[model samples]
Target chain A: MQPFLPVYAPLSDQQIKHIEDMADQVLAEVGVILQDDPISHEAMAAVGARIESDKVFTKGDDLRALIAQAPRQFTWYGQSPECDVVIGEKPLYAPTYGPPVVETHDENRHQATMADYEALVLLCDRSELLGTTGSLLTIPHDVPEEARPIAMARAHLEHSKKPMCGSIISEQALRDVAHEVGTDPSKCHLMHMINTTPPLVIQPNPLRCLRAAVELGQGNMVASYMMMGATAPVSIMGALAQGLAEIMVGLALTQIYRPGAPVVGGLFATPFEMQQMGPMFGSPQSQLVQIAGAQLVRRLGVPCRGDGMLSSSKLNDAQAGYEGAITLAASQLCQADFILHSIGWSEFGRSYNFDKCLADEALILSSI
Target chain B: MQPFLPVYAPLSDQQIKHIEDMADQVLAEVGVILQDDPISHEAMAAVGARIESDKVFTKGDDLRALIAQAPRQFTWYGQSPECDVVIGEKPLYAPTYGPPVVETHDENRHQATMADYEALVLLCDRSELLGTTGSLLTIPHDVPEEARPIAMARAHLEHSKKPMCGSIISEQALRDVAHEVGTDPSKCHLMHMINTTPPLVIQPNPLRCLRAAVELGQGNMVASYMMMGATAPVSIMGALAQGLAEIMVGLALTQIYRPGAPVVGGLFATPFEMQQMGPMFGSPQSQLVQIAGAQLVRRLGVPCRGDGMLSSSKLNDAQAGYEGAITLAASQLCQADFILHSIGWSEFGRSYNFDKCLADEALILSSI
Candidate 1:
């Protein structure tokens, strides 16, 4: 993969600095609400953070300093030698990470079964564009809830030799996947996705996932799916500040757990359509926040994870095409290091269509 | 309308200079073939350009000198006062200029009727994005070939008060439309599109159309639709040079016929796919040529006409969406002033769909 060169940055350096300063202020004043996580609170306290009840406050410098200890780039290994992937070299594409439903070309959506999950794995394996058979292609309704994580990992191991994301469901579940795959901890075999709750908060489950993955010398991705005017602020600047502050807190956790942990920062913002009461992707404001915020993420000296080929359209029609194309182009414009959900995402990431996946990857192939 | 600022220029100053040098060399050496056009030959000789049979040769400096007299920007007046469009200020969108086939949302294609042509006129009038009524939305199969151009112009005048393209089929047809609409030439009420046959040639018919429009103080657009590796040189630099030279010869004619005439330069190049034996849109090479070539056209001191929302896809699917979005984004990136074929174009500009038009425009809305 050739290195991505940013060509469509809309914000000035002064504007970026202004947003960064706001993020710093948010971290210093409002603080992140840590939910009943003593280990996280203790880690923050050890790093000289101010804590009250469930709120943990740290200066931006403290967070940045902790984040600085994390490696800016690293390599992830698969069972196969050719499957090794360099995280920050260029735009690395992965399939849809989370979707509960599958939409076919004929326009029928159904609960994604285990077969559908395995099919996506094979599709990614066959694709020339995608590197990893992404983690959590969809939730498998067929698998028993308790045994699902391990079964998913087993599918990854048996189906293909490509790198996959370990389950962040539980510390034990993730540990079992590592053992099942027999992957070396020294070679960062997995990138555990840890989603953050917005408005300056991180759940304890994801916190535990981050710590477990970091301690094992694996990659941990901190991401927030924000809907402006809803979960996030209406203004791009306000949303960016909150988004940046949220991600920084999560990044700080990786270094606090273990220095030099491989980590990626993702802040995906889509404007909330007031009339529809849902997220709207591929808007100009969405593009602005993505390009500007990714620049902010890079300032912290780490790889920024990008969301790609996302659309609210149910069918793989023109709406899906434009939305996917526009969003994907924003990733390239900002030169986002690791692109997640690069293909096969539709209905606002609710349903994955096989045809849309092929069509989107073709678009990506044409663009870059 | 907001003035567009170019943001995605990929060519370096040296590279632009190299292409310019190549264009200059081509014009001085190969020359443009002006077939059976005695008046054009006389105009070229008057400008001290060398002429041999149908070939007209002039130095790049000589061509640039003549082209410098054309207006860089102008106000095009519609019948309604609110419909005034300032060319070169921002992107002024228009509908599909030419397509003989019409495809509907139900996935059916048929020969375009007079009803389809008029429907497109009304669509453009209803559109908030599109400024002009556009030239030829589609060829009317019901209308006689000889009377089609005047019939199209009449539909634009009768349906909407928007500024529209004058008939360029002949010198008399254009004059008839100006008189029928009762439009004053001083206000630049029309922009006539005159297509250039590729491989450095402009047929006499279009030359006559260009001359008639320029004589009446109306705008003239000299555009070439070239397929690289077939009608044009395989290399982007080589294609760009040939494109610029072809356009310069036409732009120079506008000055020789009537100095300070408003003109636009369009050089649309799509790569020729070997297996398909047709032009492919949305390719990275297509974007580079569009952006770099538009910059070269801007250097000639006229508004660069852009072809937008173009695709070779047969359906209003993801392929169409990506291709249209990518191409439209290129126009915005290069800040092309007058955007033609901005919506409803499909199947390599041979088919137009109502659903695709609305969908493409929505994509543009989400983008800018």
Candidate 2:
């Protein structure tokens, strides 16, 4: 991993001040509503917030200000002069592999392997992408459960020069990976997802993952994916606000544990088919709401992340292109600071279709 | 506008070296065909290239390697937290406005003004945009021609904290406004439009303006805006590639003068109206071609720029939204690093429509 990552649209001194004030107001008055996770709830309470079941409230102005202190733009190193890319201050393009990793040199979804990781690097290098995800799209097969994080980090450091972000299954994994990446446990930017359980509640594992990522000094790209009319409110905006609340509460918790902690807020919401019980992408409204969520996060003056080449109907066909284009277009228009799943993505984050990834890279590159 | 604003994709060190070698081969064997203006021809001749009329043929590899040297990203300054945005490395959002000079303000069709600029700042702040163009559509009544650039730059600097791209009009206007805003000329990202002069020709003034901007050390964002079937080839891709070629020649000239200059290559091609003898933005092919052009530019590896809220219809209505969304969506999806006519734009960059700009911002923000 590179020693540093680049940032864009830096905040002014006044903006920083405003964010601090807002954070305090949110912490003191608004407070956060955590799910039914007593451990996280206790952690929030320990950090000077009042706890009421899953709800945690306190003044977090200082925390907001500190996180807001994260520079708007900075340099993230690449392999050399040619590979170096500035992310925030400029538009950076990265291609991603879709879900259900394909075995290297074969057709079949399986756990990711080192060869898959290497293929990703070569593809990213060959394509127009400024970076690669190391072992993107959930490389479950490559490493043992206990050693996954460290293995992934080492792969990135050894195989690629561009910046990469992803999750570690556990705290030990996070620590091991942090050591391998040489990032301060508290300042790393690892990706994680947060979803509502039945009836709009965050699950324990993801909840703990969110807090742990932040507490350890690694930035959390907290994704709040709400399926409208299922685990979330029926309306897209309603679902968006709810998702925002979940991520914000988690982010607020991290900032409290350690002020000035780096964190990125994100949303991965879409529509759900009641009859089929399937998630739907390509809904214009779904994309709209996701973009709106991105704006809402940015409004809070924090870096926001989003996916671009997202598709629900697993095939890498016209549906993928149309949905991916719409999704990528919406987020880019909304000026998402960081984009995950920008390329080689399809089938609801399953199946890394090479052609689709290449096409998506073209789309992502065009947007920047 | 350094001597050369080479458009290039991010390449591995080996690839860069390979391209450099290729460039050397081209420089010594196959060469570039420099067509158009005599000044450029003369400039190439001085560089030891063969000239035919306005055409200059050079060894291809030298130019290729020179272009490969361009930095993948650079910093752009913003006025406030709301407006702070970047281009080059990542896609940045900017707003469009109605043309105040030609249009009147109303509930639906609002004219642009200083107040409109202020409103734009608020909306831009609320939304996720990288930078802004003052008067989004065009506040002709708000500021005199002499003062337009200053007013726009000043508003962006004062109201928002985002990096801004320089305005169009005249070279002197650019310098004057840069002075007014106390911006260093070297850091400015200047913009201009190139219209096809029917069949195959280039106008002198806009060309001069582009060259002047480049000479001043300001970044150039050039667009070839064609009204298809009338001003350009009927096929959208044909028009797109031709338009890209037109700009590339000019861009190549910039590089010849200054190596590794910051430049954005862009295309804005729309279908033409036979009866009205103008252009229409409602066509979907224009949007698709725009997306394709973005791919081409990134394939070439220079920063890509284009428009969003552009329309040729004289009014702001559903046609506007549909067309604007399509175009803007393409722009964002293509990951255009810098976007002009992104907000408050209407009638194909002819007037200021604040309401339309506002709606575009809202829609774009909420877009997926």
Candidate 3:
């Protein structure tokens, strides 16, 4: 089937150009902080990037050239050939990831266990709408920190045949998941999500994971998870510029590490709520950011990644439905390539509800 | 603001042309039953319509000529100047109309009284999103049948500064409401909804109301309320053809009654659920119909009318939110000019929930 075209563009071409120029300026002048990662600093210095202590600066032309080397589209292979997905051709859906709690009708709230993780993987496998099983639909609290990645990967391998993500917490965790799944990273069976800290900073662990993934030739979804009005600029264009700068740095690094590496660029941010003293999700501002981000990614000739069916509501009530529907619809209309958190997300990604997950799957199919 | 362009088009020009041609054939060959109304029968005969008892037939060219006489767009004056709205330029929202029951947080459901009607009118008046204080948001059972129109009109006139609708049960009711509101028919303040009984029949009361509205130079929303697979054809295109034929007949009658009258066209229908033995609302099929209907209305060079925030769920729960959001988004994207049942519809329009009404209003404002 042909890919769905964007029905709405939140930013005009002139506005997109202005934001792109600003992003380039931020990359060249302000630079990005490579926090506690001397390896990244050395790598940047070797690639003609200027290194001044922790800050690494690169010109817009250099970043663009590196970005141009990355593949515009790539296929992520699943265990079954029928489950493989072409990343840049259409909007692919994945389940909500990294939630720490699970909510069911019997239990109001409980720490997610390995059993819950396996069940969720099974659900994703059975769902016609979900394209990927997703990594960490909820954190398995019963599993020890050292062995969690292996256990999660085993659950995914055993219960689902869909393409799934490898752990990004550490280099070892990423390797463990790939080895357990019998995935050849050179062919890129598993993808990894590397999130940058706000205000143009890449932490040591995430940077390490990025290097490991690139060296192994695994796909990467590089993103900046910033909170506007707090860690990033409050304005939409400003925040977009900052986000673009961060993601571009990460993406450019992937190309430098291994040219023609498969990577999806992401821009995910939320406006900070002063009263709650936290970030809000499924908001109109965030939705606009997602739409504008898609436009930017399209301009860069890379696949765009963002969340779908995201909500801050605690229960699967009207608020959850409205918020989820709005965000999901926005993602579809914006022509996002890969939609994360496509189902079972609640309470700012803290809790995953089973009934809501089922309902959201139906919603996704209806939309298609 | 400029009108919203369609985000989705369910029918292509070729398909629409085919449907229109089929509709013309239906009108000229099959004819329509003008039920139990001698006045309408005589009027149809006078206008070169072939009448045999109750069946009134006319060729496509005559109907087209009559339809061409009606204005493309007109202003609907509200009590306050700021509240006055241009009918065809953009989507105009109106509250839910003609529900006999009301639901609240404390009560499951109860018979609606005059108090409920007045409160709803007041709510619509205060709502920033609602464009019109819709007629009979809930049936005022306390009001006697003969005085219902006067009571409903008074509630709207006294509580709201927005545009509203008049009664459509009888010609007397239409004139009574107009006289009570002191509206000049030439510049219609109150619009009337005239529903045609499918397949291809206009009952006596609605025909009488239509004639009265047209003769007085008032605006009329002529529609075919069809139940697909039951009262109309099962196929979407076939149902659309039948609906178009019915509505065009009413539109022609309005033009024949008084040329250059303000009018809006509507195509409202739902697919029948065989097991449930009822029509389902807020379904994906209905949303598609609405989008295709908007394209049809646009081609006719007239404003389109439909519903918003419609749901089949009994409770204002996740189902309600999802269904309502899908339909509402579809209506907005389709560029419906007059969105009736804009808020607080539930159980397929059998009951109106107060909480849902408020939430739906907020949803509407957020979209803008």
Candidate 4:
């Protein structure tokens, strides 16, 4: 069956051009801070970037040229050859990542266990909607912190033949995942998520992980999760520009590490609620940003990544469903290429619910 | 704020034209059955239609001309001037209609009472999302059948000031509602639902109600509830064509009864689940039909009506949220002029839940 085409575009050409110009200006003038990574600082300096304290400034044209080196589409292979997936043409669903707690149908919240993690990996394997067994379906508190990534990788290999995301906590964790999976990044079996800290900063650990992944020829989903009105500007355009600038720098570094590496660009920004001092999801502003962010990524000729089926609701109630549906629909209509956190999310990603995962899987498949 | 615009259209102009031609052919050749309604048969015959037994065969152009006489937009008045609603520009939301049972938050379901009916009206009045106190929020089984319309009208007048749908069970009921509301049809104070029984048939009661409403200068929402694969063809285009032909005949009859009477065109079709022997709501095919139906209605320059937040779930669970969100988003993106069943629907509209209604109201308002 043919994949669905996106017929809706929230931004006009003039608006898109304006955003692109603003993003470029931010990259050239107010460069991003590369904190606690002297290796990257020296490498960027060698490539004509100006280093001032932790900030690394580069010309917009130079970054664009580097971005141009990355392939627009790439094959992400699984352990089973039949499970190989394409990145650019159609949207692909991946299970939710990075939640530490589990909420069940009885409304009980408890720390997740390795058993829960394995069960989720098996669920993703069985799902018709989810194409990948995403990393960190939930944090298994029962497992030691250092051993969690290994356990998660082993679960993915045993339960699911689908391609999987690699660990991004540190350089060693990334290598550990690569070694466990036989470390053949040329086959593109492992992809890693590299998130930039908001307000134009890249943390040392994630930056090191990015370098490790690229050096090993693994693909990267380079992203920035900006909390609008807090870490980023309050205006949509301004926040978008800042996010694009930050991600562009990250994408450029990937190209510098490996000139033709596969990378999916992403910008996931939601407004920070002042009263709550936290981020809000599924708001209209966030939805608009998702669409506009896709347009920007498409302009760069690369596949885009976005959150799928997201919600801030604490329960798997009507709010979760409505909010999840809105975000999922937005990602699909906005032409997202890789949708992470596609199922089993609740309480603003604080908890993952088992029943909600099953229900969301049905929703996603029905939509297809 | 400006009402949302449809940035997406499911069908292209060529596809829309093909569907229009198919529908016209069905009207001219296949015709539609006006079962047990001599008034509609005679009125249609007066407009150069050929009546053979119960079927009225009319040329598509004649029906189109009659449909053209109805105004593109009209004011649906409330008791207070401040409550008046414009039907064609901004989208308007109305509560669910025709649920026979009420489900509370505690998961108890019982036959609705007059008190429950009044509470629903008050709820609609208090809701920021619901613009009208839709008719029959629940069936007040406690009230006598003959007096139900009067009771419903009284609830709307005393408990809420929002505009409402008039009774359509019989001509007397329609007139009784008019009298209770002191309705001036010339001002289109009362809007009535005129549903065509599926498989190209118009039931006697609804037909008579349509005639009474048109004669009194009141507005009509002419619609068809086709269950695809049962009452209509399984193909989306085929079902849409059949529904369009059915509604066009009804719209033409309204014009024939009283030329230029207010009428909103509607086509609500869902696929019949053959295995379950029931109709399925919020299917992708149904969503596609809705968007295409909107395009067809826009071609006729009249307002369109559709279900706002429809679901088939038994509870306000994840299924309910996802299904409701899909239909609601489809209706809004399709540029539906007036949305009924905007909240509180469950179990395929067999039951209305109070908590679901409240939650859906919050979802709708937040989206706006």
lDDT of each: 0.84, 0.58, 0.84, 0.85
Please estimate how well model 3 matches the true structure, expressed as its whole-model Cα lDDT.
0.84
Instruction: Report the C-alpha lDDT of model 1 over A51-77, residue by residue, as the tens digit.
Output: 999798889988999899877778878
Q: How do all the candidates rank in terms of TM-score, highest first?
A: 4, 1, 3, 2
Model 3 chain B scores worst on lDDT over the 10 consecutive residues at B1-10
Question: For every model shown, what is its TM-score relative to the native structure?
Answer: 0.94, 0.48, 0.92, 0.94
lDDT winner between candidates 1 and 4: 4
lDDT of 1: 0.84
lDDT of 2 at A35: 64
Score candidate 3 by DockQ.
Answer: 0.34
Q: Which numbered prediction scores highest in lDDT against the true structure?
A: 4
Off by over 4 Å in 2: A1-39, A46-48, A57-87, A94-98, A103-112, A132-136, A140-143, A184-200, B1-285, B288-368
Worst window of 10 by summed lDDT in candidate 1 chain B: B1-10
Q: How high is the lDDT of residue A238 in model 4?
A: 91
Instruction: Name the better of 3 and 4 by lDDT.
Output: 4
Write the residue-wise lDDT of candidate 2 on A114-231 in tens digits.
6676667667666656454534444647566566566666666676666655454665656566556666553344444434343334566777776666666655555677788776
A59-102 in candidate 3: lDDT tens per residue? 77778788888888899989999999999888899889888999
Q: What is candidate 2's CA lDDT for residue A127?
A: 64
Scored by TM against the true chain B, the candidates give: 0.96, 0.76, 0.96, 0.97
RMSD of 3: 3.1
Q: Interface RMSD (Å), each candidate?
A: 3.7, 13.5, 4.2, 3.0
Select the stronger candidate by lDDT from 1 and 2. 1
Segments in model 4 whose C-alpha atoms lie over 4 Å from true places: A1-5, A42-49, A58-62, A103-109, B1-6, B104-108
Residue A228, candidate 4: alpha-carbon lDDT: 92
